[model samples]
Target: MDTQSAKDTVDIDLGGVSPCGEVIGDLGDDDMVTVLTGMKLNLAFFSEKVANLRNFVMHLETLGVELEGFVLDREDNDVDVGCVGKFLEFDLLCGVLGSEVVELDRFLDTLYAEIADAGERVTSCKPWQDNLLDPEQCLKQSEEQFSEIKKLSASFERTLSSYKRGGIGM
Candidate 1:
């Protein structure tokens, strides 16, 4: 919660001992690699979400559907169109997106909370600054990206939820 403290930063310390046996630096390559891989996964996952959002938007336009409208069978995966990502609990968010979704109105608020939680956890990312690969810098950037994704995801979720809850399509 305290994002400003040093302890809250990305913990990518790859420290090693000097001739005097003092820990002089960090071994941060692992952290850098992990951050990079995580970003790629985030990108792909968000892409699916954006796609699904777009499809649902199109469906709304085509049917003049509004939120609170009668929804067809959510059991039909084909109706659950748009960007999909797994929602990780201090974990991963992509696989969760694949689950069958029902009740978009109630679900959007939950999705927003999930993204916000990711933003908080990533804010605590801590990688040492001196590494040649600069995992700390990578963590900073990744956190920013996660924050952005959270905002966008929350927006789409709400907009789609509103459309679903409206009775236009009914």
Candidate 2:
């Protein structure tokens, strides 16, 4: 195809098509570099978010352990109605936190997979700057995954903060 026609063909954006679907195959070296750089940035951002979320989850787990210890220590006290009620509340909170940890673990697994896929796409396209690869799709998917994870992280943070204010472990 002629240069003008090639440009026209590439410019025809089809909604729902992968960002790099039609363009990558025809991209020049400079364009490939740009795309690769964007993908790298996306990877970096995703890795940082995942690390932060993991740290937060670890902190929550630690809090749960400490609260459990406190509850256990209180179990030996002389029988009292209020103490029993607090014990039940703490047990429920710990259970809910444990379930949240499990859910976060599952999410982390999926996020890790997305990161790995993005990394692989970047690696595969590095040496040859292969036109057939779809790094943009990887970038798009990573953005989406991180966005959802961020929302979940924020929600959990709010919930934990509310619990703290309510004197959960106090």
TM-score of each: 0.30, 0.37
TM-score quality measure for candidate 1: 0.30
lDDT of the structure predicted as candidate 1:
0.38
lDDT tens readout by residue for model 1, 6-71: 435766344442222334334234434454455445444544555564454454333323222324
Count of steric clashes across candidates, in order: 38, 0
| Tens-digit lDDT string for candidate 2 (24-127) | 34445445555556555655665565556556556655555555455455543344455445445544554555565466556546555654544444443445
Please give the lDDT score at residue 16 for candidate 2: 25
Cα lDDT for residue 124, model 1?
A: 27
Error of 2 at 101 (Å): 9.7
